[model samples]
Target: MGAVTMGCGDSCPLVRAKVREEWNIPDPKDLPDDDFRKIRDLIEQKVTSLLAQPTG
Candidate 1:
């Protein structure tokens, strides 16, 4: 999967509820650009790191 995924504003209460309940994730789309950019960067870093990690 790609490092970043984008979605329209949170319109689905069930999806939002499930996400909040399960992941504890704040909606990134609601965040300011700088914050969302930082999240995007962090996701990229995590994906890169995972790809680099040694695997059996």
Candidate 2:
């Protein structure tokens, strides 16, 4: 199985997995709407890139 982690803290349990992507984006909670939108866009971009990759 594959794993994708976003803003996972230092003690993330899935970090040791062989097939995982860690996007240590900061927590967007309580942020202004514009700032949260930017973070959301970034995450969407990463997801798009990941989806474009060829799977084994």
Candidate 3:
């Protein structure tokens, strides 16, 4: 369950009750190719790790 919220402030209506991970990944829209690749790789790694976990 990935949700995109404006901010994690107390008053943010988009905030969820069950967030498993919080990543501070920067926006890669204007980044160079190498930087974008790094961000993509990092996201892949995190997703892989999350999927490997046993669900309740």
Candidate 4:
């Protein structure tokens, strides 16, 4: 679940919808295998932590 924008706000659909995107700095999109692995690991960590939270 990610949103791709053309750099401007107020015009971007996500901005208008008030949807917040993840903070994935350094543009890991077309990175090498190692970089991809690192990004994957980071996302996995976030997911694990989120799932561990108690929901009421």
lDDT scores of the candidates, listed in order? 0.53, 0.80, 0.67, 0.59
Highest lDDT: which candidate?
Answer: 2
Q: Across residues 8-53, which tens digit of lDDT does each residue of candidate 2 receive?
A: 5454574465577779887888889999999999989999998999
lDDT of 4 by residue, 1-56 (tens): 33434223334563443333444445568999899889788777866875686754
Model 4 poorest 10 in a row by lDDT: 1-10
TM-score for candidate 1, residues paired by index: 0.51
Residue 26, candidate 2: C-alpha displacement in angstroms: 1.1
- Give the per-residue lDDT digits (tens) of candidate 1, residues 1-56: 11222344444444423222122235668899999988778667766776796754
Model 2 per-residue lDDT at 5: 79
Q: Score every model by TM-score.
A: 0.51, 0.77, 0.68, 0.53
Tell me the tens digit of each residue's lDDT in model 3 across 1-56: 54433224344455554553556677778999999999889888877887797765
- Ranking under lDDT, best-scoring first? 2, 3, 4, 1
Q: List candidate 1 segments past 4 Å from native.
A: 1-26
Residue 37 of model 4 has an lDDT of 88
Better of 1 and 3 by TM-score: 3
lDDT of 4 at 9: 39
Error of 4 at 9 (Å): 8.9
